[model samples]
Target chain A: MTPKVFYISDGTAITAEIFGHAVLSQFPIEFEALTIPFIDAIEKAEKVKQQINDCFITTQVRPIVFHSIVNAEIRDIIFASEALDYDFLNTFVSPLEQQLGVKAQPVINRTHGKAKESYENRIDAINYTLDNDDGQTMKNMDKADIILLGVSRCGKTPSSLYLSMQFGIKAANYPFTEDDMDNLKLPSELKKNKSKLFGLTIDPQRLHEIRQSRLENSRYSSLRQCRIEVKEVEMLFKKEKIPFVNATNHSVEEIAAKILDKTGLKRHMF
Target chain B: MTPKVFYISDGTAITAEIFGHAVLSQFPIEFEALTIPFIDAIEKAEKVKQQINDCFITTQVRPIVFHSIVNAEIRDIIFASEALDYDFLNTFVSPLEQQLGVKAQPVINRTHGKAKESYENRIDAINYTLDNDDGQTMKNMDKADIILLGVSRCGKTPSSLYLSMQFGIKAANYPFTEDDMDNLKLPSELKKNKSKLFGLTIDPQRLHEIRQSRLENSRYSSLRQCRIEVKEVEMLFKKEKIPFVNATNHSVEEIAAKILDKTGLKRHMF
Candidate 1:
């Protein structure tokens, strides 16, 4: 049986998950992971402890817990539970306290608490992305922090959304059609905004596989079409001297970060 | 002058930023933070070192650096810079390596690498959120993990989007109008799906300010109107014994986490 992994936090459990996943990645064994966020009260912690102990009895395997509980009482209860509990925040907080010469006050979800301007900026970015998805709002190109250029399924949409959601960047994406791909020239509107354009290219084989999954036996999903489109896109990007990244192997997060890094676009709001 | 803070990473620089901001929040000093992500090569490392040095020269204050560079060469360069560099990855990697009895692989953005299914699931959730935004797709209410019920500008939309974007939760939001607010009774459509409903209430003054920023001097933006609507929504929630949150002080991330914790609805994907 795969080992049970739980991410517990007094807040979002996002940090706990991030730290837990990173640490767990060193091991090859698989795990069934669950997230328990906003365990702010001792009563909730007690319930979680019961669940952890119950898992121990059922699986005869101690559950691995990665937690960022701010309350000492709750943390102690979880620590005493029949599980391998790692207190992510406390472990790092002490070292940080020593280095910064200040005690780390345990505030639940303090990082996420009402940075009103940042939150509003991110929401505005998300709205902008939604309004600009797939060249729907080409007239608003000037509003974008970066415009992603790619063929269909080259991952413009998800990358744009990720950039918006995570970093509050107003990302607009335009898909290059067969007509644009055949010409090997940038669209007139995009050419004027060349400085803000970032290209995404994928291997023909990978594109074929991805497209085929969505539409079986279609010409657009064919290996030949995929090859032609990918080659044209890469050539256009190179000819235009536009910086680009390969989306064949990377996740949306990686793609977004690379785009931001390459373009030197400020995240707009933290 | 505000002390400079740099987040350096060979990958997304997300971990660096998250950890750095958390630690820096303890200090009252203002910082002009910059994110330098995907500095994988020696040449880039040298460039970053120069920037760090320049910051020191310009500000006459040692910059605080939070880094998660996996490349030893890149790490060494930043480490040698005149900055208080906190190596986030290596600081914890060794302890985790010892615990797991395995060497931690220094893979840049490994945590963000393709978990294809999870990626697709998140995309689907995002699409769901967009399609269901503002109660436009009421037919799909049954598919939602949580349905946020609130008066206008009470933070239903952003919270729903945040839940979907971050946790892959299918969150749909419905707005209660004057008609619904007038009666303390739940709308018949919502009554059937009461189990999925989560209410969001905002302080009337905060709501007034938010709406005023959007539309000036309108009935919707009036303090009296905001007060009445908020009061009615809270009364409705109380009468129905519906679980709700005050979105007055918390960011969208905090609100989403609290919703997830209260509902016990598992995030559709990791």
Candidate 2:
């Protein structure tokens, strides 16, 4: 039987989930997972404890609970349950407090809350990314912290959004379509902001498969077309001395990280 | 002086950052953090170790290092540094291995790397959300996992994008504009998909401030107009018996989590 794992927290539980998921993924076997967030009240904690106990009764095994609960009262209730608890927050907090010689303030929602200025910057980055997406307008290119240049299906949009969302960076992406394949050169707007340019390329076969799914049997989705477009775009990137990464084997997370790493971009953590 | 901290990983280090940030946020003081990702090589690890040692020598304070490095050799190199290391991954892995009666098969990039099916689902959801954003067309409302209803600039777009980007939920948002305030009613498509409808309401004053920043002194950004639109849309929500939440003081993460909790939408972890 697959083991049962629960990620519980008083806040969004996103941190708990990420922490547990990372640890669990190292194991070879699969485990069933559930997330229960916003467990601020004693009543809610009791109910969750019951759910864990009931799962233990049914499965004949103790469920694994990973929690970052801040409230001592509610956390104690969870500790008293039949589940094997991994107290993520308190585990690190005690040691840190000792090292720093200061007691932890332990405010709920501090990790993901809107810290006024950073929150505004993040929202602005999102809006900026949206407005400048898909070569929509070059008028605002000068305002962008980074401009992504890539073919339509080579993973530009998702990477741009991830950069802006994960880090408070103003990202704008522009596509290099088939129309620009013949005499591919940087537009005047993109040339002026050449230092901000980052390129993404994909394996032609992968590009063909992606485009075929979107537009089957069309010339745009043809293998020949994909190969030609990728070649031209890559040559342009080389000629312009622009840094680029292959998106075929990497996720958006990896791509975004690689871009920031190559460019030495400061990641503004929220 | 602000204590220096590092989030290091062999992969994207996103998990390390999230774990470190969550733990550090519990403290009342600010930290100076630097993230070094893709640290897969021994030379890279040695250089990072040197940097940590250099910082200790300069400040006479050991920097706090949080690493999720999978490779034992590379991890040990960092372990030899003068910094106070918080090894996030291995801390729980040993206990988990004993509990599960299985050895961990540690693979790099497992946490955020593209797991084929989940990655495809996420990308598809992102495309669906973008194509259907702002009620561009209600034709696809039938296909959405959730439909967000709110006035313009009341946090619809960012919330919808977050739901799709983070949780892989196809979130479609529709705006109730100034014109809709005179006779606010659900579109036929929304009425048919009422079960998937979720509402977001913001404080009129906050709404006024958000809109004013976008379009200065316009009737649309007027405080009275903001009040009228919010009141009418909220009434529509009540009359339709649609569930709603106040986005006034909440971040997008909070709003998204609340929506998932209220709707019981299964969060597809990427």
Candidate 3:
């Protein structure tokens, strides 16, 4: 088997899948994709070195590595990792050329960009669905590119999947746990990915009303808990530099658009 | 466990999921959903009956059953199976409605009202994407209400998912197997559902060319074998009274639209 390219990025996996899928889609080469998210360049350096060595022993061709992420810590990690293994590697030049030059392949990249975002959004939605549907396979939705920080029963999963299905965005979401309210801090990862972070909050009374249907007791499903999560989470977002949207009584389209607008990401025309 | 209300159907699991999901999405219910597809309605009738009997032994609320399927044979099997043991069964009003009505809470039937033709187109599209997308899971593309169909690698899944991502339709597809070719007939069930049937055929040379990329030297990848399958299978469609579309050198959109036009089904308006 030919040694497949290793695309290591601190960016969300959806982004990696988009660009990786793009290259694979065009070229006829065996590919094995591995993703490590939330790694600042600094955090990625050591792991990147190990991945390169693993690629060499496992396959026949030189490894192709692509890294596209915004975290400076991860950027620093890539720089150090690259310095450590300078041989047996080649960089993708087109992305740089496109960034610097005008005549880049627009259509393909546009699809990749769209797919990347969509994949992220799907992940977020899947996580939300898992949380709500079966409460199994639940991951920490906090580290998501877009932590759908909303009430217990809002249409987080559908909204997330809608975002992914429509735009291919890597979206993750965390229902505000009671701990978040008492301690009053977004998860630590959300704090780290603060600029790229987004919050989804819904009305407290509505939250209580929605929850009332599920739990046997209306006490825990009271307006008090709903009010508390919404108020505390919003305050936490303010303190942690996270942007958020009020999702109470909003359709999935409206809520998703609000996040895109606040973040200034042009809704990819689907 | 509360005696759950299950809406089981014939055809693909995606259809079952859509129906199950849409039902849950609209109302507040304390029932767990277990919907399986690609199995005939008899399997569903039996399983739900067993489940309902189990609940009868434990719970006070009777199981509310909702089922939708096109094949009259399957309906006979379900009615016969359920009539013996199950007392609380409310049948779907239209198999087409269960499959089509997007927003309303469907209580009695699943009918798309020419929606099967629409779904058939979507299915054709899904089959195309399935044969093509490397490892990408286009599972959510069930919303594609139409699918294009033909031989192996005839742009079915891609077109279906494209229709879905492009235009929120639930699409699915089945292939013309060697058996279907030699026998020159759609499955008996598909024959009665002929109004819902749309066929896809392509130039042998074009199909052979597409296969060459995946399996280089097999006779299946040869234009001769391609021609044999295309000719023989198409003849069967003609003899069995089914409609088909020729697919050669056309974009997926064009082919899907052609199928839509020929089937006389209204295109999904986004």
Candidate 4:
């Protein structure tokens, strides 16, 4: 039987889910996972505890519960359930408090709350990325924290959005299209902001497949065209001495992280 | 002196950062955080250990180190550091392994790696959201998982993008501009997809402030205009019997989670 797992928190439960998922992924087995977010009140915590107990009664197996609940009352309710609880928050909070000589002033929703200035800055970054996306305007390239260059659909948009949304980075992207293949070079605006330039390349076969999904049987999706565009864009990157990465095997998280790592860009955590 | 914290990981260190941030947010006092990612080798771990030791020697206070390093040898190196270690991964891994009666098969980058099909689906959702954003076209409303309606800059675009990017929900947004306020009614496409329609409202003062930053001293940024638009759109939302939330006090994470909670949308965890 697949093991059951629960990610519980008084807030959004995003942290619990991420930490639980990371730990579970290390094991070579699947888990039937459920997330219970916003368990702020005692009643809600009781109901969740009842649900966990019911699952154990039916399955004859103790469920693995991972929670980051800040409220002591609500957390105690979960801890009393018929499951092996991994209290992610309190496990470290006491030790941290001891080390720092400060008591934790636990507040619900603080983990994901909008810290006013940083929140507004994040919104600004998102709007900046959208306005500057897809070479829409080279006028604002100078303001961009990073500029991603690639052929069409080489994961530029998602990577750019991820950077802005997750890390509060003002990311602008430019596409080196099939038309630019003949004499592919940086635009004057991009050359002026050359220090912010980063290239993303994909395997030609993968690029062809991605294009085919959007515009099937078109010259844009053809294998020959994909090969040519990738070659020319990669050549331009090499000649210009721009750092690049292959996006074919990496997810948006990996791609964004790699870019930040290579560029030494500071990731502003929310 | 602020307590120094380090989030160290072999891969992106995103999980480490998130978990550490969540844990640290419980405290009232501020902390200085530094993230070091891609620490896969013993040599890299040793260097990080040296850095942590240097921090301790300089401040006469041990830094708090939170790491999710999977490799035992590399992990041991960090464990030898002078910092107060919080081994997020291994803390629960041993108990989980015993509970499951299986050894963990630790692989680097699995948490955020491209698990091909889901990664593709995420990209598709992002594209769908972008194509259908801001009522760009009513044609694709039938295909969206959620449709957000609000006045201009009431947090529609960012919320919609967050829904798609973080949760893989195809969220399309429509703005009720000043023109729409005169006859605030849902479009036919939106009326037909009423079940998916979610409304966002904001406080007039906040709306005015947000708009004033974009267009200074214009009628569009006037407090009166902000109040009128919000009133009309909210009235329309009530008349149409659409579910809604106030976006003034919430972050994108909170808004997205609230939407999912109300809509019963399954969060497609990447």
Q: What is the TM-score of each candidate against the true structure?
A: 0.87, 0.99, 0.33, 0.98
Interface root-mean-square deviation, each candidate: 2.4, 1.2, 22.1, 1.3
Residue B117's lDDT in candidate 3: 45
Q: Candidate 1 has which clashing residue pairs, if any?
A: none
DockQ winner between candidates 1 and 3: 1
**Model 4, A1-270: lDDT tens per residue?**
998899999888878888898889999888998888889899999999999999999999999999999889999999999999999999999998898889899987788747987798789999999999999899999899999999999999999999999989999999998788877889999999999999999999999999999999999999999999999999999999999999998889889989988999987654
User: For residues B1-270, could you state the per-residue lDDT of candidate 2 as single tens digits?
Assistant: 899999999999888888999999999998999999999999999999999999999999989999999999999999999999999999899999988899999999888747877777788888888899898898999899999999999998889989988888999999988888778899999999999999999999999999999999999999999999999999999999999999998888889989998999987753
Instruction: Give RMSD to native, each candidate.
Output: 3.4, 0.9, 28.0, 1.2
Give me the candidate number with maximum TM-score.
Answer: 2
Candidate 3, residues A251-270, lDDT tens digits: the string is 44445555654675433322
Evaluate model 4 with DockQ and give the value: 0.76
Pick by TM-score: 3 or 4, better one: 4
Docking class of 1: acceptable
Tens digits of lDDT, candidate 1, B36-71: 898989999999999999988988878889887888
Between candidates 1 and 4, name the one with more favorable TM-score: 4
Is model 2 an incorrect, acceptable, medium or high docking prediction?
Answer: medium
Q: At residue B156, what lDDT does model 1 achieve?
A: 86
TM-score of chain A of each: 0.94, 0.98, 0.47, 0.98
CAPRI quality of model 4: medium
Top lDDT prediction, candidate number: 2
lDDT of the candidates, in the order given:
0.82, 0.92, 0.48, 0.91
RMSD of 1: 3.4
